[model samples]
Target: MEIVMSGIAKAFGTNQVLRDVSITLKEGEVHALMGENGAGKSTLMNILTGIHKADAGTITIDGVERTFPNPREAELNGVAFIHQELNIWPNLTLLENLYLMRPKRNKFGMLDKKAMLAEAENTCRELGIELPLTTEAGLCSVGHQQMTEILRILMLDAKVVIMDEPTAALTERETATLFKMMRKMKARGVAIVYISHRMEEVFSECDKITVMRDGHTIITKPTSEISVDEVVRHMVGRSIDEFYPARTTTPGEVVMSVDNLKPEGFDNDISFSLRKGEILGVAGLMGAGRTEIMRAIFGVDKHNGGTVTVNGSVLNCKKPEDAIKAGIAFITENRKSEGLILDFSIGSNITLPNLDDICPSHVLDSGKLNSFADELSKKLGVKTQSIHEPASSLSGGNQQKVVIAKWVGKKPSIIIMDEPTRGIDIGAKRDIYDLMNELTNDGVSIIMVSSELPEVLGMSDRVMVIHEGRVAGILDRSDATPESIMTLATGGQ
Candidate 1:
């Protein structure tokens, strides 16, 4: 299938999301769409699949004009979209989830289980996919759930498939499997629109690349023609000399220490220490108990045994309030659900955490709240019309900034950031790194838990690798190479 989108323009109130964007997708090719958050890449795709009508544009499939009324219509016409967040019914079996949308019925008007099973088995055999079809979806691994989505698309016989950040949550092995499936689809004359910020994957798996900036298409070229630097420059509209700032300050005395923390469901005890003005990076494979340790330390989860000492004082791990009252803040990995209330205004979200600062003497001060919100928003570079605007209105990168700002307002001495740069654009990542450096420089210690190896290596003063539920090893900044970290993460000595 060949698809062409030209002169696409969309506006939400006064915000012009897409301005004169154009792109072409050829048959049997993998085309990559690269951009920062709020760059209008998702908007363009939404318009193509009929999620939203473009204010002015034209889309043609196989040289014929078309505008699908809805995603279901697009899918019926051989177009499918698999979003980053897999839409799987956890309570149902894998087979049930796959055939839920289009179930076959027999002459008696009952469900045709035999037909569905045979068809699914045939497709799985052809694609080299193996899974327990009768098992519940929630019991399967993330990779399996993702493959189910892809298989569902293939079952539709989709000529064109659009993937948005397909491997964002997959492990290395799972990512390889996903790329292999893409190759199989390409051989069958299917077109793929791949959207991701991971440059390495795009360069390795995609045939063509298109970079978008500020609601406009900057350039579209073969993957071989453009360098990573050029693509980043085009996406950000400037050259970034330093994506991760160098750490210059020396850490002072230890501020927090964990002594043999045995969180529930852990097979081994965990221990770590954070010093003043230092960044302690936690790295591990998925299901390696990296997040479990953080949640237990922050009182979000129960610990069977351990003692947390903050500035030589024992902390009561009874609730999250204890940690917060002791001048510690946690930024969870699932920011949308735990970090911010989407319907609340940015100002209200900020005020939720620091009510004491905003409302002292048992009285609420509206003026003080506004000033506090304004101060943090401007300081953190939150791109919003006003602090009163709903948090849902901001982009992912900006919402992350708001989450950080919400904690920064509390003036905490110790901050724990889990997946700080996940799902954000590169430019915003640079901003967050700079902010972390500034925070550490000002004597605020940081515990950064990240899945991205480059991020942990680039921003850490000390790198701690966890294998299974145990602390594998800790290395100084100079000793934390990719090989060294991965070796420890995989249980190598």
Candidate 2:
């Protein structure tokens, strides 16, 4: 099967998202759609998947012009989209979740439970998915849940499968398993549309690369013919001298300390410290309890045992309010859900955390709220028409800036950022790094938990490796290396 999209154009309220975009996918190949955030990649995919109508475009499958008015129509035409966020119910069994919408009916018109289970198990066996079918979908790891989604897509006999950030949250081992599955699908003549921000995955897994910049197709080339630098240049329209900004200050006195902190659901001890004017990076594999440690400190997750000391005072942070009152800010990993309320206005979300400051003396100040939000938005370079505009209206990078601005407004001495740059564009990432540098230079200590090794290494003054909820090791900037960090992450002493 072959699919071609030509002259795709889409616009939203005078904002042209896609212009003259074209792409082709062939059987037995993986095509990577590479672009920075807000580059119209999602818009193009939405048009192709029938989620949105294109202003002008032609979609031809096997030489026949086609249009998918709805997702079901696209599915009926042998196209399936596996979004980054898995849409599976945890309470149901894997088999149950897979066949939730499309259930096999026996001749008697009853649900075919036995056949469904058999097919699910056989599919798993064929795809090399080790997850069991009887287990609850929620109980399985993220990788297993993703595998189940893929299995469902295969059951539909989809000719084309679109995977968005498929391995973003997967561990190294899980990613390997996903790659193995992708290869099998490719061998079976399944055209895979793999969308990811990780450059390594594109080079390692994809066959052809399609670069899009500012709603236009930049170039399409074989992965073997392109270098990472070349791809990045095409995506950003320029070369980046430094992906991470250089540190300008030395660490001062310790600002925060976690001594033998023990959070729920883990047996190991956790300990770390952050100094004023320091960017202390926490590196670990997925499920290594890196986020868990931050949650414990920020009071998002209750710690079973241990004490938290902040700026020479020991305070028990039983709730987030306590942590906030104690001058600590936590920028959560899942920004859309936790960091900002999508339906809320930019000004509302920015001022949400610091409401107490703007609303003192038991009175609400509308003027103060808008002015404060406007100040923060401008300071963080948030691209928005009005502070009253919804946060969901902004691009990924700008929303992240809003998250940081919200915390900065509180005047916290220490900031905790989890997966700070996940799901954002390269340009936005550079802006965030610059902001971090500025914040650290102002004596605001930062504890950043990240899965990207380069980011941790480049931005950190000291790197702390977490292994299964325990502090594997902490190394000074000069002493930390990829090998050393990985060794510690894998439980090496």
Candidate 3:
């Protein structure tokens, strides 16, 4: 089956999200869509999957023009879209969720439960996914839930499968498995449209690449015809030098120290110390307590036992406000729910945590708020028409910038970033890496939690590998390799 989208245009009120965009997917070819945050990639995928209607366009599937009013219509036509966010029912079992809408029936009109369960088991086995069929979806890790979604798509017998950031929440081994499955799908003549910010994955798995920018298609070419830098240049419309800036200052005296920290779900005891001007990386497999440790340190989650010392002074933190007042900033891993207020303007969102500084005489001060947001946005290079625009209107990368700006506005001495570059394109990723360098140079201590091996190894001066709620080992930059880190992270030590 082949898919051709021609002259597509879509608009919402005054915002034109997509403009005359054209894309083609040949049978058995994996097409990669590349773009920066807010480049209309999601909108285009929505239109293709029947979530939204195109103002002007023709969707030709196998040489037949079709207008799908909803996802069911598209599903009936063998089109399946696996969104970045999982849509599975968490309370249900994996087998139940897979056969939710489609049930096997006998001649007497009774549901065939045995047949559905057998089919689900077969599908999981075929994909090389090890999941308990009876286990609740909510009880599994993020990576396992993602695998369940992929299995659902396979069971549907989809001719055209669209995957959006499929590996964003996966570990290295799980990602490898997915790539193998993608190759298998390609061999079966399934047209796959893969959307990802990871250039390495795009080059490794995709056969054709399509770049989109400012609501329009830039170019569609073979993956082998271009380099990563050239693809980035096309996506961002400019050349970037030095993605991660080199550190300037040597690590000074220890600024913060934690001893015997234990939080719920994350067991055992953890201890670490961060020196002034040092960027410490925390690496682990999914559900290995990296996020739990950070959340506990920031006072977002309650700690059963721990002692935190800042600058040789014991700090009492009972809540997030206490942590904030103690000069600590936390950037959450889930950007959508934990980081930004979508309905608020960029200025409001940026100054939300530090509203007191922007107000005077017990009244809101619009001038000070706008000035603060303007200064931070300019420094962070956030691409936006105006600060008055809603945060939801910005792209994923810009929204992340707003989150970082909000915390940086308070001038926190210690910053903790969890998966800072997740789901963002390479161009924006470079900017974030540069920002980390600038902060460390200014004597701001940073604690970063990441799942990507290259990013963990490339950016951090020290890496801490955690396995099953414990620090397996700590490695210096000189000794941190994928093989070495994975060995510790998987309990090989």
Candidate 4:
């Protein structure tokens, strides 16, 4: 199948998202769509998937002009979109989930479980996947769940597959497996649209690359002809050095301390101290207990034994409210689910956690609330039509900013950021790093938990390596090399 989108344009109110963007995909080719957040990549895909109508554009598939008014129509037309959020029921088995999307029935019209199971088994075998068909889909790993989504699409006879960051949450082994699956699909003459922020994956897996910036198509070229730096320049309109902001704050006296912190999974004791005006990064691989330690400290998870001290005051935090009242804030890992209330307006979500700031008289002052939210939105450079708009209306990077804005408004003494820049664009990441630098410069200590090694190494005054839920070692900024951090993270001496 060959898909061509020409002169695509989109808008929301007065905000123009995409302007004259075009892309082409050939049969049996893996094409990468690269762009920063709010650059209209999602908007273009949404239009193609029939979620949104383009203000102006043309879509042609297999030499036939097509218009799909809805996602079902798009799917029926052999175009499938695998969103970042996998669509599957946790309560159903893998086979059941696959059948739910594309049901197979015998001549009598009764549900054909045997036929469905046989087809699923055959499909898995063909893909070289060792998935458990009878096991609950939710019980499987994220990589497996992703493969199940693909199988569901394939069962629908989809010819063009659009995957948005399919490997974002997968482990290295799982990523390799996903790559193998992509290769298999490509070999089957499938036209795959791969969108991701990981440069290495794009360079390795994609045959063609399309760069978009500020709602316009910057360039489209063979992946081999362009370099990573050149692609980044097109995406952000600048070089990579500007991606990570330089730290300007120096470490001071200890402001927060965790002694002998024991969570359920780790084999050894966890201890760390954060000095004032410091950014202490926690680095480790998946399942490294980095997030668990932060959760325990923030009172979301109970610790069997430990002492948490903030500014020489012992904290007996038994709940999130207790932690917040004690001058500690946490930006959780999953921002969409845990951080923001999608149905609420931008102003409402920002002030939900800091109501006291605007409701000192036991009632919210509407003017003050909106004013505060507006200021935060401006400070974070969140692009939106209005603060009254729902949080869901904003882009992923802007939504993340709202999450940070919520906690930063509280003026907490210490902030714990878990994967602060995950799933965001490069420009937003630079802004987040700058915000951290600003906060620490104001004596607001920070504890950052991240899987990205470069982020930990670049923004940290000191890095604490966690292995098996235990503190492997802490290295000063001068001594924290990627090799050393990995060694400690792997439980080396």
Q: What is the C-alpha RMSD of each candidate to the true structure, in Å?
A: 2.7, 2.5, 2.5, 3.3
- lDDT: the better of candidates 3 and 4: 3
Best by lDDT: 1
Q: CA shift at 258, candidate 4, in angstroms?
A: 1.7
Model 1, 145: alpha-carbon shift in Å?
Answer: 5.9
lDDT of 4 by residue, 165-232 (tens): 78765645457777887887889898999999888889999999999999999999999999998999
User: What TM-score does structure 3 among the candidates reach?
Assistant: 0.92
- The parts of candidate 1 lying over 4 Å away from their true place are 85-96, 103-155
Using lDDT as the measure, name the better of candidate 1 and candidate 2. 1
Task: Report the candidate with higher TM-score, 2 versus 4.
Answer: 2
Candidate 2 structure quality by residue, lDDT tens digits, 1-493: 8999999999998899999999999999999998888888878888889999999989999999988888888888888898766878989998898899899999999999999988887876776556668899877755578777767777888889898887766667667878987897899999999888888889999999999999999999999999889888999999977788888989999989888889988897787888999999999878788887888888888888888999989968998899999999999877886899999999999998888888877587999999999999999999888999999998878989999999999999999999899767777899999999999999999999887888899999999999987899999999999999999999887
Task: Give lDDT: candidate 4, residue 36.
Answer: 93
Alpha-carbon deviation at 438 in model 1, angstroms:
0.6
RMSD of model 2 against the true structure: 2.5
Point out where model 2 deviates above 4 Å.
Answer: 90-95, 104-151
* Candidate 2 residue pairs that clash: 90-138
Q: Which regions of candidate 4 are displaced past 4 Å?
A: 88-99, 103-158, 238-240, 265-268, 490-493
The TM-scores of all predictions, comma-separated, are 0.92, 0.92, 0.92, 0.88
lDDT of each: 0.90, 0.88, 0.88, 0.87
